[model samples]
Structure formats: C-alpha cells, structure tokens
Target: MENAFLNSLVVGAVLLGCAVFSALAGDPDALFDFIVPPGVMPANVSANNFTFRATKADFVAGKLIVQKISLAELPTLDGAGVSMATLMFPPSVADPVHFHQRASELLQVTSGSLFVSFIDSLGRRFDQKLFAGDAFLFPKGMLHYQINLDPKKPAHAVAVFGSSNPGIVLLGPTLFGSGLNVEVLHQSFNISKETIEKLVAANTPHPL
Candidate 1:
C-alpha cells in the first residue's frame, strides 16, 4: 500500500511540474511535445517614395510639402548622372519647357487640377488637362511642361523619374545655344528657313 501511494505521489508531482512549466511559457501548447510557438511579429515596411494626404493646415504658402523619401539628394543623383526633383506648382503656376534626355518621366496627380503639354521630336504637340485622380506618361527626350489650372486652389502631382539620377535638358537651351545652327532644324523639320530663323531669333538668350 505504501508503494502504490508513493507511485501516485510521483505521478502527481510530475503533472504539477508540467503545469507550472506551461504557465511560465505563456502559451497553451507549451507542454505539448509536437507544438511549436510562432515567431516574433514582423517589422512595418514603408516605401522609398510615397505620399500621404495632408490636411488644410499642412498647406503653407500655397504649397504642400510632400516628403521626398528618395534615397539621396538631387545633386548626389546628378553626380551619378541622374537627378529628380519633386516639383510642386501652386495654382496658376506654369513650369518651364523641359525634357529628360536620358530617361522618361511618369506623373500622377493626387489632388487638384494639372495641365500637361508635350512636344514630340516630330514637332507634334499633345496637351492634357487632368483632375484630382488623373495620370500621364511622358516619353524620354520630349519637351514637356506641367501647369496648375485652378486659380484659387493648389495642385499636387508626383513625378517619378526613370533614371537612378536623371537630369533635365531644357529644349530651348539645346536649340538656341551650343552652336546648333538654325538651318539644320529648318531642313530636318520641313519648316520654312525664314520661320526657323525667326524662331531661333525669338528663343535667343534662353533662361536658366
């Protein structure tokens, strides 16, 4: 009888030790031999380039500052022979005629009115007026501009440059300067020589 009582006591102590270990483990299946605990929670991942909505208070001086989440600054990108700038044009603002010689640009308007114009190598011009949720793609080496149409409210658009570091080559700057003779354009584009001369003359002294 003592032996049986001691056997029962040993069994009860073993079960109690298992229960205590399970309580300390903080999982229901801690005592189970085949059950494994899950791993830790994952870290939150964000974008290299992203934009979140800003309230009215966020807009200062008619411009809403969108965080550039780019990996590096514009000049660093330029030194690698590429650069991109986050351009924010307030209402009724007009951007200069620009082109990316090395890469294309993709634009998406998150809010307000945006007007885009582009002139192709063949001298064909395309203009588009977009609203709050519109997007456009501009081909590389083409002249393009973005303007805000609304006079009272601001417009916000995001431009993703194709190159790791892309630079802008203004169209007039190339045509007017660098000793690119006007006659070449007249002969290539099938425009009148007089017209070409007049155009070059008008665009002389291009702005930086």
Candidate 2:
C-alpha cells in the first residue's frame, strides 16, 4: 500500500507539472502529444506524407482571405505541433477580430503594408503599421486583427503557428451569428434589440 501510494503521488506530480508547463507555454497539446500516450504512432511516418505544397489557390485574394494548412488538411502534421496559413487582404479590407485557441501567430508581411493590432487580457490594445518584410506576433488567445491600408492594392502575409491545430474563434461571428439570444446580447453590449438582430443577421453565414 505504501508503494502504490508513492507511485500515485509521483504520477500526480508529473501531471501537475505538465499542466503548469502547458499553461505557461500556451500549448495545451503538449500534455498528450509530448508524452505519446498509448496507441499514438509517430506522425509523417510515410515518405509521401513528408512534403506539403502550396498552390495559387492557397494565395487567392478576397475581402479577407485566409488559406490555412493545418492538421485538418494534412494529417501528417498531427504530431508536428506546427502549421501555416496564407493571408491576403484586399484593398481597404480587414481580417475579422479573432483569437487562436492553441497557438500564437507570427504574421510576416510579404507585400504591401498592413495595420495590425491586438488586445491583451487586461483589455489594453496595441497597434502598429507593418510594411513589407515586417512581422507581428499575436500572443496566444488574444484578440487580433489586420487591415490593408493601401487603397488600391492588396496586402499579403503568411502566418506561422506553433500548433498543428490552432483553432480560430472570430469575435463577431461567435457573438452575433451563433444563435445567441437577443436578450443576452442586448444586456451584454447595451445595444438596442433591433441593432443586435441586424448584427446577427449580417454576421450569420449563408448556406453555400
């Protein structure tokens, strides 16, 4: 009984250490991924899975285009803990305010310029204008956005993430388009019911 208790204590301490490390690193995937719990095989074992290619469509431009190459698109990246996305912002367009759940993003401007900003947990906002070859880091789980300041040309960038499955949570869509009750929004934002409904209607995605 004493031996069993000591083993359990060690296991508990290890788990607690992992949890604290993951929280500090903003990488919850580390807990299960690093230890390689039972039945988990090594990623990208097959030679064919070793390569990834980006095509023209990946860089296609739109209002606020984001073509991501995450674990969902490449199963080989399942254990890699890394992913990338292409960003194209059309003239005067802006990427929606969003946050990555699992990974911080490093956005590097490739062409044109962009106005970038992020809001920290304390609600303090930071912003800057990034030109070609400039980069910005958005801390994990912080709300961030970027806008193409050029009036006639589009801006391009690439975002590198530290997690294979970095999940995006868009503020507008989450708030207005998720069938949230009108009363909830009205109370939260102190906005009129009509305005809230209009926002919901505008943000709701149409069946494609």
Candidate 3:
C-alpha cells in the first residue's frame, strides 16, 4: 500500500510538471497524451480530416487567397501543435506588411516566383527572391511582405507555422485603421496631419 501511494505521488508530480511546461511553451499538444489518458481518441479526429482546395471564392478577386487550418477549425490538431495555410498571389500582387505574433512561419514556393522582404528586430532589412521549389523562413514577430514577381502568372506557396494559432497583424490597417488618435500617428510617423489623414483615408475603405 505504501509503495502504491508513493507511485501515485510520483505520477502526480510528473503531471504537474508537464502542465507547467505546456503553459510556458504555449504548446497544448504536449499534454495531449497525458490528458487523453490513452485508448480514448478525440471525437473530432475522424471528422476533421480534410483536403485543402483553393478556388476563386477562396481569393480576394485580384489580390491573394489564403486557406488556413488551425486548432479552432480542427480540434484534432491539438496533438499536432502546428498549423498551415496555402497562399495564392496573383500576378504583380503584393501582400501587405505583416507579422505573426504567436509563431514563426516557413513558406515554400510551389510555382512561379516571389519577392519577399522582412525587417528584423533591429530595424535591419533583408530581401530574397524565391523561385519554384524554394523556401524561406520568417522569424516570429518580424515585419514582412511578399510580392508576386511574374506579371503574367500567379504564384503558389505553402506556409507552415510552429503554433496552432499564428496571429497576424497587418501594419497599415493596424496602425492607420485601428481608430487610434490621428495626432499620435502623425507624431509617431513624423508626418504632417494632412499626410496622416490621407493615409488613414486611403486605408479606411480599402486595406492593403
């Protein structure tokens, strides 16, 4: 009886440790095996299996299309701890400057070419030109943008994230369209109020 009690205590300690680690790492998938207690599969496992297909409705007319899969869409992926999306950029189109707060992204170009640029934490800029079958990595929380290089052909790429939910923030919309005080933006950007107003106005009706 004493041995059993000590073993139970050990197991409890291990579980507590795992819980703490999962919280710190932001990886709930790490606790999947322990939480599910073995032999019991999650209900959504079968239902969530799917194939991703991109169509006209998936894109924003002439710009880009992103088809994403995440934990919110498929709970079964909780064990996988990763999410992905496919991006389609029409010729001469560009994705706005953006960043992912919760995860880093790896983009693999499947067809055509892409011109990608990013700014590091120190405000240093890096640019790369990717061709078919090329890949690039964008560090988490860094500002980045992508432009389709081919004016006659569309480009296709797959982006994988380290976290289930990779939060995205578009720089222009978040800054100009977020309804923050116009004076603050003017001061922060070192631009005149008229310039700020024009920028805000341009970003209001249509966000790039």
Candidate 4:
C-alpha cells in the first residue's frame, strides 16, 4: 500500500510539471493567472506650450501655415528614448534655415510637394525634391530646411527625432528676435529695419 501511495505521488508531480511547462510555452497574452489589467493612460508631466499661426491668410490664397510641435512634453517609453511632431507648411512657404544641435531626425513626407537642400560649412551643396512618399534623414547639427514647392497645394510631413525632448532652437527667433538688437541683425543679414520688423512680426506668437 505504501509503494502504491508513492507511485501516485510521483505521477501527480509529473502532471504538475507538464502543466507548468505548457503554461510557459503557450501564447504570452494568455499566460496571466487572472485577467490582466488594461494598459495605463499616458500622463502629462509637463504643460505644453501653445503658439498661434503668424498669419491669418494661410487659408486664403498665397500664404503659409507653419506649425511647430515641441517634443519635450511627449511621453517616454521604458527602453526607447524619443518623441516627435508633425510640421506642416502651406504652399509656397519655406521653413527657416535651421539645424538640430543635439538630436538627429528622420523626415518623411506624407502629402503634397517638398523641396529640401543641404549646405555644408565649406559651401558644398546637395538637394532633393520629395513628393507624397519620400523620406530623408538629417544628421545631428547639420543645417537644413523644407520648402513647399507646390504652387497650389499644401505640404505635410512628420519628423521623428532620436531624443525624447528634441528642443528647437529656432534660428530667427533665437538670433534675431531677442538675442541681438535690430542694428546687429541688419548688419549681419544685410536687410533693412522694415524687412526685419516684417519678418519678426510674421513669427507666430510662441512661448517665452
């Protein structure tokens, strides 16, 4: 009778081991002992800045709508460290010549026409005209800009950055608006005060 009991115990242990292995090997989603809780909602740890478009005539006829989205307020994943925003430029408008000092970026065009050009410190040059489904990568600290070449339509694109909060150091706003006075800017860019005022005034109201 004792041997019989020992045999029964051995069989029960074997069954338990098989069950454990089966559970582990099966679909990962079904591995939870009880129905797992749903995913958590994204948290807003910081307040996002708001800026209005510089021009109201963007929708009228011959103006541009440039939307700036800052990546700093976006949520971060555990292993991946990045955030992004879509920038839209209306027809015939141009993004200011700029550079991302710290973060590299991948810009993928989704609609309309886009013209991008590259310029090096030594005056070397290269450029490409992208349509609805083209993508390009701009390395960190390299200067670049996107222009809407379409004569009658708008252009849209998404920019993916390598950092969670890819800060934008806007060239015009940073250099011309606050840092240097009108006299300095006039000397640097070889433009008149009227032109400077018009350009500065065209800038969308941004966070201070």
Candidate 5:
C-alpha cells in the first residue's frame, strides 16, 4: 500500500504539478483544479463566519453528477482538515479507477449498494460489496474504483476526506485521454496497437 501510494504520488506530480502550481498562483485559466488547498482564508464575507451549509446542488451540475465539497465550496473548511463528496450511481454505472493525491477516503453508503475495490502496493486487490450504512476506507493515493451493481435502483454514497482538499486522478483519463504518448502506453502495458487505439478512442474526451 505504501509503495502504491508513493507511485501514485509520482504519477500525479508528473501529470498535475502544473495544476498545483496554477492553483497556488490563482491562475483562472487552469484546465481544472488540482486542489482548492486549505489554509487560505476567504475574504470580503459578512461578519458571520460561524457556519456554512452545503447540499448536493452546491457541488453537482445536473442529474449526472459526482460531486465534492472542499475549501472551494465552503471556505470555513479552510484549516478544518476535512471535506465531503458524494457518489450517485445510476444502475450499472461505474465510477472507475481513480485515486486521491492528498488524503485517505472514508466512504459510507447512504442508499442502495455498490461494490468497491482498491489495489495495494504488492498488487493485492482488496474489495467489498457494501450495502447502505456500510463504510470502506481507501488510503491516500491508492488506485481504487466503485460500481453500482444493481439492475434497478440507483446507489449513493458519501465520502469524507482527511484533507480539506483532496484531488482526484483518474486512470482512464490519465492513460488514454490525457495526451500521454501512444508508444509509451503501448510499451508499458505490452498491449497491441489496435487495442491501445481502441481504448484511447473510447476514453477520448469531448467538450460539453
């Protein structure tokens, strides 16, 4: 697990180091936020700095959503060492392989159920089927994924992170859609060119 975490950090740094720099520099042109890092206080708000509230809408876009609330959503969370996110899975939908660069995740099912798994340093996979009220932990930087296996009802889970801002690194996007060279992927996975091109095509991103 430790080694896996370290490897993930290296990959994240290689891919997203500029994202981190841009966020710190407050560059609005960043492709996406790597982290809304904590400890920076919010400015120009009303005197009432006592509390904050957030609902799914605060973090979600539409019916199709996987959302998180960090310092970006609630400035009060700055320095609080905590953040929350939600996973809403339509039946048979997958929230595929991904990792958090900064914090461990503790996720609790709130509706329906899902199967979750993580791969450790030694390549040993740990997985579980969780029903509502069940919880699982994935240590920081461990590659992991979740799937809603049900055929009918939707599933939902809530996750809490140990850091105020935990950024995600997704495997599919990183490998197939992020513009990593084809030769590198072909050699690393030792897969055929046809298969590689198919995966790249499947994962290619299109603007909304």
Candidate 6:
C-alpha cells in the first residue's frame, strides 16, 4: 500500500510538471504532442533560453500570502516545466473552498498544522489534519479547502501544481459574485431571491 501511494505521488508530480511546462510555453494544446512515434528523434529542448523569478502576493483577506513560480516569471522552464507556490496562513485563517480546473495540486506542510477537506466526484467528503512534514494531494477539479488549525501560530505549506496556469474558481465568489441572473441562481439553488441577494452582498470584496 505504501509503495503504491509513493508511486502515485511520483506519477502525479511528473504529470503536473509536464502540464505546467506546456501551459507556460503558451502551447497548452501541445500537451500530448511529445509522444512521438518510434524512430523519431524527440525535439531538442533546453531550459537555458530564459530566466525566472519567484513572485509573492497577498490574498485579499490579509490572512494569507502566496509566493509563486511560473513561466511568466521564469521563462527558463521552457523545456522542463513546472509551477510551485508557498502559502503562509496566519492563525485561525481559512483558505476558502476552491478548485483548479487544469491541474492537480500537491501540498506539503512545513510548519504548524492544517485542517484540509475535499469533496470527491461522488459527493463523498474526505477530511484530514496535516502537521509539519505531512503532505496532501488535491486531485484536479476537486473542491478543496484548508484552515490553519493553530490559533496562536501560523501555518506554512508548499504547493506544486500540474499546470502553469492552473485556473482557480472559488466557490463563494463564483456563485455569489459572478453577476449571473439572480433569478437564475434563485431557481437553481432553490433559495429565495432575498437570500440570494444577501449572499451576494456578503461576498462582495470579502469572500472569507
């Protein structure tokens, strides 16, 4: 069982690395083009053509900051493509429910603790508490969230994604602030119009 899990992790990492590389190269459509037929020399590619820098940004909630690496900031990954980010969450803060449409994610906790949860395709939910040195995987397109379990200390984790442009859709913002027809939402959610309005109001510029 342990060996299988480790093998899966390795496979996931390789897939993510390839996806990130392709997306960064602005050739997402070429994701599977590397599988050349026999007797063909693979295209010669190298990571020496460009440079890369890690960039940092603060989340809107002010409780978290993420430092990221991608092709945009590091063009040198043209051949060997991958993307990564380091997330720092302050005490008692939560990373809201969201999903990456294009990439699976691997997270490694370096400090403190985190409570992670996700819902699978069958609507079954899985939850785990991760401490320092622990790792978690969020499969592509799965809805997942995390919370800092420590009230006095901060939590830190490193995240690796399969795609350079792994798109993120936050549940609350997408549902409440997307500017879709309120009546449509009311009908779809089976909720009153007034409740939809209230939810839209609460999510404005403050999803947490």
Give each model's whole-structure lDDT.
Answer: 0.64, 0.83, 0.80, 0.65, 0.77, 0.77
Report, for all candidates in order, the number of backbone clashes: 4, 0, 0, 0, 1, 4
Candidate 3 segments exceeding 4 Å error: 1-28, 34-61, 204-208
Among these predictions, the greatest TM-score belongs to: 2
Task: Give a tens-digit lDDT track for model 6, residues 87-185.
Answer: 999888888999977678899999999999889999999999999999999988999999996778888999988766666789888889878789999
lDDT of 1 by residue, 10-29 (tens): 99999999999655432132
Write the candidate numbers in order of decreasing lDDT.
2, 3, 6, 5, 4, 1
Pairs of colliding residues, candidate 4: none
TM-score of structure candidate 3? 0.75
**Collision pairs in model 3:** none
Give the total clashing residue pairs for model 3: 0
Clashing pairs in 1: 82-165, 82-166, 83-165, 83-166
Candidate 2: worst-modelled 10 consecutive residues by lDDT = 31-40
Tell me the spans in candidate 5 whose CA falls farther than 4 Å from its real position: 1-64, 205-208
RMSD to the native, candidate 1? 22.4
Residue range with the least summed lDDT across 10 consecutive positions in model 1: 33-42
Estimate the TM-score of every prediction: 0.49, 0.78, 0.75, 0.57, 0.70, 0.69
| Model 5 lDDT tens row, 1-208 | 9999999999988879888764553213324323233543544444344345545353232233567777667765655667888878887887878898877899999999999999988999999999999999999889998888887778889999977767788788678987778899999999998899989988965221
Off by over 4 Å in 4: 1-71, 77-79, 190-208
Deviation of model 5 at 194, angstroms: 2.2
- In Å, residue 88's CA in model 6 sits off its true spot by 0.5
Candidate 6 residue runs with Cα over 4 Å from true position: 1-62, 78-81, 204-208
lDDT of 6: 0.77
